[model samples]
Every structure is written in structure tokens, then in C-alpha cells.
Target chain A: MQVRFWGTRGSLPVAPKAGTIADKVADALVAANGRSFADKAAALAFVEDDLDFATGRSYGGATSCVEVDMGEGPFIVCDLGSGVRELGLDTLRRCAQEGRPKEWHIFLSHLHWDHIMGFPFFVPAFMDGAKIIIHAGHPDAEQALRRQQEEISFPVPFDWLKADIEFRTLETGREYEIGEVTVSVILQHHSHDSYGYRFRDRDGKVAIYSTDSEHKIDQMHDENDFAQFFGHADLVVCDTMYSLADSVSMKEDWGHSSNIVAVDLCHEAKARRLALFHHEPTYSDADIQRMHEETIRYEELTRDTDALEVLCAYDGLCVEL
Target chain B: MASTLEWQVDKRDGGTVVAASGRVDESTATEFAEVLGEHAETAGARLVVDLGGIEYMSSRGLRALTLAHRRGEEAGTKIALARPNETMREILSISRYDMVFPVADTIEEALAS
Candidate 1:
């Protein structure tokens, strides 16, 4: 399976302001100094290889959406945040290029505004021959999506969408076979609550999407159900929207977890890799990089082995297993 | 496992020290507030909170603690958080609550400060 992140920002979506972009440009110029490059390739190489990730790269501004490619089957997507538009548009392009139909199985973490906001803007939802299955742990998932498409909030009504759409309720902790993949979910702590999904493909490869769920160390011990569920997964996408300080002190009960918590949980689970997801909108690229670095440092300090890899989930990042 | 909080109060000569353990999430914040309010009424002189025993605290816990801090200020009692663990210190720093309440390494240190 191959996993790609369409959006990684948490809560609200955000982009670096013009001034921030300008600063990056100014820094790039300073680094170039008085040296002259021969061509665009040379300049591009400088930006790609010479410049630091904090100054040169951004984690994208779109809110949470991820695609899991389950090899020659209907595409499996997690969360329909603002990033779903990109996925929708890409899927349409693919259908046109391949001269065939497409199906989407979208698993929602919760009905929070960010998670449900993308469905309305998904162009394919209005197209003919698009089969869309929305799986959710929340019983009211259909209503929440429909509510957004009401005339008061949107131009197109929910009923006007031409796609064959269906909502299926997932029983948390129960495994369900969807085509070639089997999925299991666990109810997680959030404001309106959320669910974390674990997907195992036909080849026996496991990929877990555990977003928007807050994990409390005081409660979830190393030998708890979560640890067992997360054990030995290839990847665990987690909510790390706050600093350890923020999550505990002021942002407590805010339905978000910290980088430290994610690292600790993934470590205990003995998961192969952990991707920090649901980034705080207010944090700049530099801040996110710092947090990523801190998480790495923390893992190095605490982890018994280098078996577990930690990475930040950025927009357009693809990980193949 | 169930999420619960334990509060142990030991009034010292310099101030009243309260040690907290377990968690302070949405469910237990109300109870934490009630118990803290009861002790705060008589802690006009000073109050020291030992956060070492605390394993977890959430935004609800922050709200409860902030309210207690405000009440102590109104009652003319100095409030300090003592022996905060790494997680607690990070929380306090990110929220900037460390600036609001003095944090010390120990109850005696908090009282002395």
C-alpha cells in the first residue's frame, strides 16, 4: 500500500502570509550571495539541495486528507478535509485519462468542520458514474455532510449531487472486510469524539490512520488496548496538534495530542513508523520543523532501538510500504 | 482503566500544599474545581500546588487551575505550582501559565518564593 497526504494542517487551514514568503525569498537570495548560477537547473538544485527544509519547504496549508492506495482497487481515503478537492480533481483526471469509472471509499475520523468541509467542494461528487462510499463511526455523519450543503451555507444542495453516494456506519473495534482490505476502528477522545482506523490489505501489510484522537498518558498505559491495536503497524498517522505544554496546560480537553505523546504511544506500540499529523494552523513551517526535530530528538533519547522512524505528515508527502 | 484524580493536602507553616495525581481531563475538572475551591477559601495566606504526582492534565484542567489562581489572587493569597514534571512544564510554558503562577522545584521552595 502507498499512502499520500493531501493535507496535514489541523483545526483550521492556513498558509504562510505574503511577508513570510517574502522572507524566504530574501533568505534564499542572501544564501546565493554574489554567486551566479548557469541555468534554472543550477538554481533549482540550490533550493532543493542547499537550502534547509525549514526555509525552503512548507508542510502545505490544506486541512487533513489522506489517500491509501490499496493496489488495483477502489481508492481508500481518510478524512475529507479541504485537501479532498485535490484528490477529487486528480481522480477525475485519472478517469478521463484511463477511460474508465472510479470508486471512492472515504473513512471519516469525525464530523468536525475541517473533516467534513471538503465533501461539498469535491467536484466528482456531482459527476455521473462516481461511486462514493462514506464510512464513519458517527451515526450522524450523513446529516452533518448534508447540513453543510444546505442553501444557507452552500450554493448546491446535497440532493443535487449526481454521484451514487452511500453512508456506512462502522462498528468500532469490529473488523469489516471491504473488497480486498479489512478495517478495524477504535473510538478515540475528542470534543464530539473521533475514531481511529486500522487497515490491513490483502498482502497482510498494515497501515493505521489514527487522526484527531487525543491520547492521555495518565490513562492509556503501555499494555492497554490502544498499544495492542497499534502494535507492529507499518505506519500510524497521529494527531500532534499541540506542544506537550499546550496539550496539557491550556489546550487540555481540546481534542488534540502533542508530538511527545505520539512518539511515546508509537514507541510503546512498537510501530515501524509514526507520522505526526493534524498540525496546528498557527504554527509556521519553521515551528513545525522545530517540532519535528524535537520529536526526532525525543525518540532518539527515549527509544531503545532505531527500528521506529518518526516523520511529519506534510501536504503531498507519499510513503510506500 | 478508569481515569481518576487524587488530591492530598498538607498545610505547612508557610502555605497550604496540595499534591495532585492521575489526570485532570474533561470529566474530572468539575470535581477538581469543587475540591480546589473548598481548600482555596481558607488559603488566604498562601497555597502551593505540587504537580509532580500529576500524570496528565488537559485544557479543562487548565481552566480549573486558572480559575483557582484567579480566586487566590482575589483572596490576597499567593499561588505557586511546585515540582512540575517535564510534561507539565511544557504545558505551562506553551500556555504561558508559568508567567501567571510561580513554579518551583518543591513546596518549600514555592512557599519561600
Candidate 2:
């Protein structure tokens, strides 16, 4: 199975300011040392090889959406954040090439705007022969989706969508077979509560998509239980949205966690890899990169067993397990 | 180079001081938290945690301190951390735990404050 991050940012979508882009360009030019590239390919190689990620590329501003590709099956994705728009476009291209029916199994963590805002612009939803089954722990998932598309809020009504859509209420703790994976969810601490999913494929490769969840200092049991849920997974995409101080103090009940807690939980779970997900919207790429570096160091300092590979998820990143 | 954590509680005139040494990590964090909580119950107005001798502290250790801070707040005992080592200080800063508790350069300063 392969997991692709279409959106990694939390709260809202953001694009780098013109000044930020100018700096990246300036930095790249300085590193280039007035050297001229023969072609576009040569320039790309220079950027990919010599320049650092924050300078050459960006951690995109898309929110929440991730795709779990099983090679051949109904499309499986988590969340419908702004990132889903890109996914929808890609799906259209793929479906056109393959001449296949469009079916999407979208597992939502919550119905928050950042997680569902992309649905309105999703091209597949307006196309014929498209089947969208949205699975959520919230029974009112359909209501929330419809409410967002109401005339006052959006120009287009939800009823105008041409595709057939269904809502599946997922019960926590119950395993459901979706395509080739067995999926289970656990209730997470948030405002209206969120759910974290664990997906295990036929080959026993596991991938966990857990975002918008807060692991509190006082909640040791929840941490332990979540660790169990994340146990020995190949990859665990987690919410690392705040600094430990902010998470425990100012943002305690605001429903987000920090890289410190993310590393601790993944370490306790003995998971193979941890993908730092749900980037704090206010942070710049440099800030996210620094947090990623700090998280890797923390994991090394607290190493008790096998080393856990720490990765920072960026838009368009695909990890195969 | 991981050492077992050890702590001593001293009832000072102005505050209760909990002096800790060694590594406060996953193995010792629960006991560390319990000790702080137990001492906080008897603390008068202030509780100072002396981290000068700590060799290493992990997220678990941070959680212990956080819980201690909350406990101190509820019991009307102001909790402060003092003298975290260079590496531990960086950890505290990176994790933003520095803002959660009043960190001092010395136990004397912590108790005085």
C-alpha cells in the first residue's frame, strides 16, 4: 500500500507570500554562484540537489486530505480538505485514461471546515458515474456536508451535485473491510470529538491516519490506548500542530498536539515510521522544518528499542509500505 | 549513561523544594510525577523543582512536570522549575514547556520568586 499526502496543513490553507518566494529565489541564486544552467532540467537538478527543501520547494498549504492507494480498488482517501481539489483533478485524468467508474471512499476525521471545504470544488462530485461514500464516526456527517453547501454559504447547493453520494457511520472499535484493508477507529479528544483510523492491509502492512487529536498531559490512559492503536504500524500520520508548551498550556483543550507528544506516542507504539502531519497553519516552512529536525532529535534521545524513522509530510509526498 | 532518577523533598521557609537528579525518562516519569504531586499537597505557597542535576529528560518527564504544574495550581502552590542543563533547557524551549512553568536559573531564585 502507498500513502500520499495531498494536504498536510491544519486549520486553513495558505500560500507563501510574494516576499517569501523572492527570498527563496534569492537564496537559490546565491547558492548557484552565478552559474548558468543549460536547460530547465539542469536548473531543476541544481535545485533538487544543492538547494535545501525550504529554499527550493515548499511545504504546501493544502489542508488534511491524504490518499491511501492500494493499486487497484475504489479510491480511498482521508478527509476532503483543500488538498482534495488536486486529488479530484488527478482522479479525473486517471479515470479518463483508464475508462473506469469513479468511486471514492472518504474517511473523515471530523466535519470541520478545513476537513470538508474541498468537497464543494471536487470535480468528481459533479460528474456522472461517480460514487462517493463518506465514512465518519459522526452520524451527522451528511448534514454537515450539506450545511456547508447551503445557498447562503456556497453558490452551489449540495443537491445539484450529479454523483451518487452516501454516508457511512463508522462505529469506533469495530473493524470494517474497505477494499483490501481492515480499518478501525478510536475516539479522539477534540471539540466535538474526532476519530483516528488504523488501516491494516491484507499483507499486514499498517498505516494510521490520526489528525486533529490532542494527547493531554493528564491523559496517560488515552496515550497508552492510542499507542496500542498505533502499535507496530508501518507509517503513522499524526497531528504535530503545536509546540509542547503551547499544547499543554495555552492550547490544552483547543484540540491539537505537538511533535514531542507525537514522538513519544509513536515510540511507545514501536511504530516503524512517524510522518509528522497537520502542519500548523501559522508556521512558515522553516518553522516546520525546524520542528521536524527537533522531533528527530527527540526520538533519538528517547530511543528505547528499534529506531523509528521520522519524516515530515509535505504536499505530493508518497510513501510506499 | 542513563541513571536512575532520585528526588528529595525539603520544606524550605518560603517554599517546598524538590531536588531531582539523574534521568527522568519513561521509566522514572510516573514516580517523578507522583513524588511532585505528593509533595505539592504539603507545600505551603510555592513549590520549586530543582532540575540542576538532571542528566536527561524526555517528553514523559515534561508530562510529569506539566501534571505537577496543574496540581500545584489547584492546591494554590505556585510551581517553578530551576536550573535545567543546557541540553534539557533546549528541550524545554523546543517543546515550549519553558512557558508552561516558571523556569529559573537557580533554586534560590525559584524559591524567592
Number of the top candidate by TM-score?
2
Runs in model 2 lying further than 4 Å from the true structure? A99-101, B1-5, B74-76, B104-106
Clashes of 1: 5
True contacts kept of each: 0.06, 0.59
Tens digits of per-residue lDDT for model 2, A50-101: 9878889999999999999887678889999999999999977877787545
Candidate 2 global lDDT = 0.89
Q: TM-score of B chain for each model?
A: 0.90, 0.91
Q: Which ten residues in a row have the lowest lDDT in candidate 2 chain A?
A: A92-101
Residues A21-77 of candidate 1: C-alpha lDDT, one tens digit per residue: 999888888988877899999988998988887777788999999998765667789
lDDT for residue B98 in candidate 2, whole number 0-100:
78
Instruction: State which candidate has the highest lDDT.
Output: 2
